[model samples]
Each structure stands twice: as C-alpha cells, then as structure tokens.
Target: MDYTALTEAISSKSYEKIAEMCDDLMLQGSTEGVVNNEDWPYAIHLLGHIYVDDINSARFVWKNVPRVVKENRPEVTAAWKIGQRLWTRDYAGVYEAIREFNGSPEAQSLVDSFSEVYTKRMFQLLRSAYSTISIQETALFLGMNEEDATKYVLQQGWSVDPASTMFTVKKQAIVTEQKLDPSKLQRLTEYVFHLEH
Candidate 1:
C-alpha cells in the first residue's frame, strides 16, 4: 500500500478522491478480520475534512471507529481530540489540533481546507445557544468586520434596526398542550362505569 496517492489526494483537496481513499482504506483494514496497522492512520487522517463536508457522516464514522483502534493510532487519537474540542465549542483547542497535525502532510492538508468550513459551522453552533447576537459579536465569531456583519445579517433577513447594532434571529415558536385542571374533571368515574355497561 503506497498511500502516496491518498496523501496527494488530500494535499490537492480532491474531495471525491479523499472519500474514495477513506472507503478503500477502511475496507482494507477490516478485510478478513485482519486489520493492517497502517490503514488506521491513513483513514483517521481524513476525519477532520470529512467532518467539514458531512457532519452526520463524520459522526457515523466516529462511532464505528473502535476504541482500541483509536488508542493505537496517533492520528485517530488526534481526530478524537478535535472531536472533543468541537463538541465543547473550544475553538482554541481546535486550532491547536490543526497546528499539532501540521507535521503530517495529509492532516495538514485537511486543516488548511477547513478554515471556511469551521467558520460556517461555528455560526450554526452559535445559533443553537443564541437567538439574538450583536453585530460586533457576529463579526468576532465570523472573522469579519462589524459593518460587513451588519450587512450580512440584514441580507439574511434577521430582525435589525438601523440605530441598533444587534440583530435577532426568528426562532420557531414552541407550542404546548394546555394543562388539564383537576377541578374541571368532575366525574371521570361515572364515565368509566357507563363504558363498562
């Protein structure tokens, strides 16, 4: 297994090739229940990029990766570290992981391509916690200037006032069933007796 082609595919930022190589390596590692040690690193090295492209698929892959395999492969462990950082919204830790992987050509390639992906994902994550955000905060999170952030929010149809620097995201209204009043339920016992007849 040369693995040079896989490295080249990552370095070139060929998404299709990267996916194929990940699949191929995974298959090779598990074939006949005899795993090749090298395939673990080669496949684990691409997880960050995979996460950027398809988070659900990345989660599926992460879940399937055996704990034993992750412990034995540095790249697998490194990817796990990144996943932990991502789960906790630790941006600094994520960047640190990228830096840590810089020595590995394939992992570094994935890290370099993930800059845009990370920013978009950060916004998605923030929306779950914040229904409204100020222009300055959005700018800081998105790595853009305040004016641009304001313009972007306005373009996205966020509720904004010209005089104010904050915008509000319109979240879906939650609906709940009205609670029953025990005092109003006068005689459910009578109804039960009639049903028995």
Candidate 2:
C-alpha cells in the first residue's frame, strides 16, 4: 500500500471524514495495537496532533469524533490545546496543564496517548536530521557553506528536519543564516545517528 499517499489523503481530509475513516479502519481491525504501531496509529495520532495545533482543524475534528470515541473527546481536545501551547514554547504552561491533566483519571489516558505521539514525532525529526549525509547538500539547503552548516548543527543542539533524508541548497542556506551553534549541532547529530542504527 502507498502509505505516503494514504497519509496525505488523511491529512487533507475533513474532520468528519477523518473520523469516519478512523472508525472504518478500526472496524477492520486495522487499529489493533495502534499505540504500538509506528505507521498506522501513529499516522492517525499525527492527524489528531495536527488538528490540536490548528484551531480550525481541531474544531473540525472535535465536531466529527464518532460516538464510540465520544467519551474520550474532551481529552483529545485538551491534548490539542496542550500540544499547541507546548509547540509555541510555553513549557511552563504546558507542564502545569499536563500536571492538572495527569491528576485526573479521566484525562490520564489521553495525556499519555499525546505523550507517545509527541515522542514518536521527535524521534522522526531526529532521524531526518541525522540522515543528512552530505555537508554540501545540507549547507546548500540551509544556504550555508560546509563550515557554517557544521557550526549550525553543532550549536543548535537540535535537529532541524527529522522526517526526511533530503536537504536542498536553499534549506542549507537557511540553516546557516540561522547560525545554529556547534554544540547544538553535535547533540542533534549524535541523537540522529543513534537512531539510524
């Protein structure tokens, strides 16, 4: 099956359609161990994550959640809010919300599910950054030279792209201009490499 195509279709679909698709897939036993399956459930979780981050999208998803998953609806909405705040770098606020949610038995499952989905995303990003094999290619993509690319990677201590192996000259230039620190680059490279094997 063309997973990329499938994911793209899912990503662009309406919240109602996505909910229906999820339900259909689940009925087909396609969601068994979804939390553990990196591709299927992970992709669905990503859709939910995107919805949570995008306000309009989240509302759509919330409106469409099937009755079977209705009990877990609020938690899903909460997860989206938590994720958006977290993505905006509001670590303190995110933590506080997480703490409050964690305290609630009703919210624990959803929170845990969000954590797993988020972790998987991080790993995927790390993998993308590490898989970049050529300094020139990386540099060009970031709009930097080899030296700057190395410096940025070493300094940023985080992976810029963790989903794909390809990087272009323009992207390299962007990375270089961003002036990623050497230490950060090293950390990101190390983390990404560790995942490669």
TM-score of each: 0.51, 0.28
lDDT of 1 by residue, 1-197 (tens): 45677767766677445655776766775775665544455444446435445545565666777777766667766666666666666665665665575336556556556755776666675566688777777776655577876676666666775577677875545789998877656577667778999
Model 2 quality (TM-score): 0.28
Best of the candidates, lDDT: 1
Task: Please write out the lDDT profile of model 2 over residues 1-197, one tens digit for every residue.
Answer: 23343355444543324434444554454445432222234224424444344435444444555554545445544555565565575544554555455323423544554455544443344436654445555454343456765566556443444345333212222343577799999999999999998
lDDT of each: 0.63, 0.47
Candidate 1 displacement at residue 161 in angstroms = 8.1
> Stretches of candidate 2 above 4 Å error?
1-56, 59-80, 86-106, 130-197
